[model samples]
Target chain A: MAKKNGLDGYCVPFFDDGNKSKFSLASIDPSSKPFSTGSKETDRERLAEIGVLLDAQQERLHAQRVQRVLLVLQGMDTSGKDGTIRAVFHEVDPLGLRIVPFKAPTPIELAHDFLWRVHAQAPAAGELTIFNRSHYEDVLVPYVLGSLDKEERIRRYGHIRDFERMLAESGTTIVKCMLYISKDEQRERLQARIDDPTKHWKFDVSDLDARKLWNKYQVAYEEALAATSTEYAPWYVIPADSKTHRNVMVGELLLRTFESLKLEFPPAKESLKGVIVE
Target chain B: MAKKNGLDGYCVPFFDDGNKSKFSLASIDPSSKPFSTGSKETDRERLAEIGVLLDAQQERLHAQRVQRVLLVLQGMDTSGKDGTIRAVFHEVDPLGLRIVPFKAPTPIELAHDFLWRVHAQAPAAGELTIFNRSHYEDVLVPYVLGSLDKEERIRRYGHIRDFERMLAESGTTIVKCMLYISKDEQRERLQARIDDPTKHWKFDVSDLDARKLWNKYQVAYEEALAATSTEYAPWYVIPADSKTHRNVMVGELLLRTFESLKLEFPPAKESLKGVIVE
Candidate 1:
């Protein structure tokens, strides 16, 4: 592994060391075998077909007037959050869907409790809300950047857990995802930005400086997952080096979650009178 | 024409009409040719095919970062605003879209001008916003229910025209649609609600009372349209008697509007330097 400055090329340490150990993939190892060989391409086609099923299921969820879904996507810069959202939800009804991207807190937001802004964006009953990047930021970025003191960060972890518990009590189901991409892949992507003029606008030299701290961020994510993953809202570590894999995984995961809800359209109150196809 | 309630069936007006002119098929005959024998099947197939095209075109528009789109869907109770939204926007990227149902104004909303609530929901640049019944409610529902006096109703038409113009200036393109279903068809739909327990919850008997004043509403709609339809936001009179026709017309209209916007994705900023996609 390459080393730069005070950072290891492939390892990031942003969270408490105890949390990093939980991400040790017992059965899914990057080095064991090629996860994306020719078979993976066929798997992608199958997933797209299931994506249609996901769309219909989502529609039924809307009509059922039951639970609300909150999809939380957490990833490093250029980890394909935007691309994945576009692909997976492209065929779902716009009526009951909402997407909110959380940027850095403004002065007003910082003045409130950490979860205040996140709560306001929650979906109402019978709707789906996608968080492009969500409350996990309170842990990941702050810890990585040392924006808060060690004591402050620990207090926030407790705050987040309580806030999520409140959401669960209120019938909000959360699906959190951390898109895992290797440093080699990230470097290649950043280099592509420098090499291709059409992509240059997306590249910031400063982003590479942050890339130097990649290992630290990875450690932080692992810790956050270990601490916050609960039965009500589980974190799924998705392989996101390949855009296709992330999209298909997210779609399949959404389908399974919705299936578990067992939603159906509310039954009409009376008998059919004069409704005919013609 | 079957007469009811001492009114000539031919003379009964359409719903959602505010003050302008008492319209009959006499002057414009805007309704398209009535279906010939066996044409319903052909129309149905056309609708499904259009759904595919609409899906693909919406995806293209989203990826290309083109002009914003506003779909204004207005209809009588059960005339299918919700269904139309589901059908037409089924394939759109949820991140790039929003759907807002204009309900009876809340107290804060009522305190402001009618357009205040509407302006808040308009789509941003490079997005699509669908209003399942929109600002037009200021003209439609209020007019049909006789909530506003003649002088007040006429003044609202001017406010609506200017509000739309402002949206256009802010880079939002508007597509306004009125779903025209015959009174007999509406009654049949309502009766079906009573007959089917699954749909009974949707029935509101008072909707029939509103139906009784349909002719007055039609006259109101004709006047509103003649005065407010402008180049920035052209109104399309969709033949909504058939669900197939309604879906295809709305889908094609959206596809054509996006095509006219001449969109292209914002090009990649630069060649990848520190980025990678494996």
Candidate 2:
């Protein structure tokens, strides 16, 4: 049995010709850390190393000033979306990175097409951007809450596939991750916040309402990921119960993805080689 | 003689109740490093310490979920706006910082009121946002290019002061910095970029056009900073000849500003005190 090595082995294959039901989200274990170095201490060290490598690669990308990269992170509450960003990109210069966190839509956002806000924040030339939450919220929330019909959900997913394809073709490398956590883990995390007064600012009663609909959200995610995963923008399931492992895996995945771009510093200019400052 | 301490000494005095010209930009030296720890290596180490402290403060701000902070960076070409962000924010979580780089406006942006695009990107509650270049461009670029008459320029500065005051009154703490670098320093920085072929992507031919109007831009900046510096939104003149000193000064300034906020994690919620997860 050949052990899964890199992130490609975990990517949900591109959905073509309406095969949205083929990928099963439940089969993956939420506790597995295939990318981890087995020891938690070693995993932290590896993540730090990845951070430096990522910082260098990002500098090159910004220097080249051509391609753009967008990372979309979607997960249940308390699944470490914020932690992963802080840890994995600690060494990457914040200059080249744009992190956009989408909260509930405001009235102005609701007035436009679902993708309007997302598109406005898309990475520009020489930029690497991350969507903390994304337009995927539109399909996931409405569908799970029964506000969107099955046909409408499928249509929206199709629209997402097309939108991502266009961005990919226009020089963006799109990577999506769903941080997977078990229901039991969520209970402990939510309870810990409740136990500490200082953490109350982070807790929302409405979050519990969403937790009540966990199964539906899980199902919605499965369908959405299955429908929109493409050769241009593939989705990966990250086991996120262990925070260190989650950071390590995400760091490795992004490092590998960036390396695949083969980004390089543009050739030196010959026009002003001998030019000296006046 | 007593030495000036903290960021207040560099701060452009607040233009309150129609007082504007009392502070002069020319009085500040672009080469001074009042905030440095006397040695370059020590200043760098101090900056790393500030980075961690700022990072912790930012986390507290995020946890509090109330106040917002906006850092507006304005400078001459090659005056280290991007470098300041990268070095000062190295330890801060990218998740908490939002960097908005304002390039030359597009036709759509130009069609709206100058502040329209900017207002849309204001820091939301709990966000620490940086405007790499901001609405100040409206005052400097046009006034220097002679497209905007002094009367119109003054009116625009009034508009900016009001806009920033509004952002401030709405619980946003605004700290603006003008990275001051000498003409000779900028010439060296720009020429070095031109001399390095790999750095061509960062160059714009139009940047040279701006450099040609250096004296005019400086005059414009001095006037605009004088007029717009207000009680609620103050601007600091950061000596930026030494990149390390620039970073250290910025880090200290922001750290001090954030500390003044007295941000704390929200108090524990009594409602969920004994509630256990099902």
Candidate 3:
């Protein structure tokens, strides 16, 4: 079967009203099942090949002085943003990668515009900045909490889109992904946390309240993807039910995005007359 | 052959002259050799021990509860901060470590107080944040360049100490290291960079201009250290002539500091009775 946009035929179908209830992921996404049960040897071999390709592409990227990448991952708690980043950039040089995890804003942050804190964290050229949760929290948390009026929420949506566009204009390639997990999966994970004393620290009783608003969050995510997805910064809905599939898909997507960038190391400064890489 | 506060015995006699430079850099401080040419194997073995110790400490830090570690590295260009971090943390779990490299502030950063940018990068509990260059740069860079008057520089000195104190109060264990490299060694390294094309990318011609004021910077560093070093965030003057020695010392110091915390895994919320580590 021909893959959809080279996504191993696992592309998220365009949101449709008729499919709203059909969005349930009771089983693994059919499109991703191909490599799910593949032999361990075959998987290892594929990973090794990808690693070599990634190394060459990263080398070229450092040399060519290409645009930086801004990867924004948004999802509900335990939706696998951290795990995805770990699996995706497992082999990448830490020097070239930056992860910014935004927590509740401090007093100083509250005094400024929502974007102020985020603007300071943008990656420089020729780097990758991954946001475990980004400026979207400004909208997501506020929207879910209903702290902002509908009009105010709508206004902020445009502001976010414009801000992302500005980042792109300044030579950042933005890839935003939302790791979507079903309520059933979240319940199972949270139950695992409650059942295992080793995971107790991760459970805050308040989380169950959020779990009750699962349908609300699903609608919010759909709205977020529809509103903020732009040519400069597109959104990808990642099925995060299966950790292995999520890991492999995120890695493959990153490899594909980086491959598309024609990067090369900048020429050596003329001030050095004798330096060589070898 | 008694070690003084874990420093080499060379430090005891020098305590009387606390005003005297702690640095033994020949070209930079003109008093002692930074490299130990003898007992290389002992140093290497010690470094391996330190590496193992540090790994254990870091694991405990991660498990005990997330604690933030802010490691500040300051020195003139080619002083080996980048190289030191690479060697010391090469095997560290990337999930728990962050290296923040500071440069000239962007326009937005400049608009805010200088500390704003630095504050944003502070690690959450349970992370090791390495500052290749940190807020100290505000004082070091400005002092060395003579861009700030004495009054302003002194003011910045107090500000930095306070900022660090606040960071420490907020559960961050701060370890600051100054890589003391001699002028002759720096010249050799600079020349090597000029001689090798691969290393050419790191060389900046302006380093020589800074070399001319090397002594002035040394005086500045001494003053800054004296003014700022405290019981909580003491400065480690590392002998950096040998790359191996420098890395080993840093690794040992970090390992020692983290071990002193006596971290334990935060008890998990749920029982992990059935889970397997593998």
Question: How many residue pairs collide in each prediction?
Answer: 64, 3, 32
Interface alpha-carbon RMSD, every candidate: 5.8, 1.9, 7.0
What digit string (tens of lDDT, one per residue) describes model 1 on residues B5-110? 1212222232234422444433322234232223777766666666666555555556555467788887777677877877766655566667888877889999
Q: Candidate 3 — which residues are off by over 4 angstroms?
A: A1-5, A8-37, A40-66, A104-116, A138-156, A274-278, B1-5, B8-67, B93-95, B104-124, B138-170, B215-223, B268-278
Cα misplacement distance, residue B171 of candidate 1 (Å): 1.7
> In candidate 3, what are the lDDT values of residues B1-278, reduced to their tens digit?
22333654322122224433444333244224344335778766766677667766776676665577888898887889888876677556556778889987889988998899999889777788898888787777778888978899778877887888898988999888888887788887787877777655566677777887888888787767766666556777777877887887778778867867878767764444443221
User: What is the alpha-carbon lDDT for the whole of candidate 2?
Assistant: 0.87
User: Where does candidate 1 stray beyond 4 Å?
Assistant: A1-38, A105-114, A189-209, A267-278, B1-67, B192-213, B267-278
DockQ for model 2 equals 0.67
Docking quality tier of model 1: acceptable
Interface root-mean-square deviation of model 1 in angstroms is: 5.8
Q: Write the per-residue lDDT of candidate 2 for residues A187-209, one digit (tens) a residue.
A: 99999989887788889998899
Error of 1 at A217 (Å): 1.9
Candidate with better DockQ, 1 vs 3: 1
Query: Each candidate: fraction of true contacts kept?
Result: 0.60, 0.83, 0.33
- Badly placed stretches (over 4 Å) of model 2 are A1-5, A17-19, B1-5, B17-19
- Give the 10-residue window scoring lowest on summed lDDT in candidate 2 chain A: A1-10
Model number with the top DockQ = 2
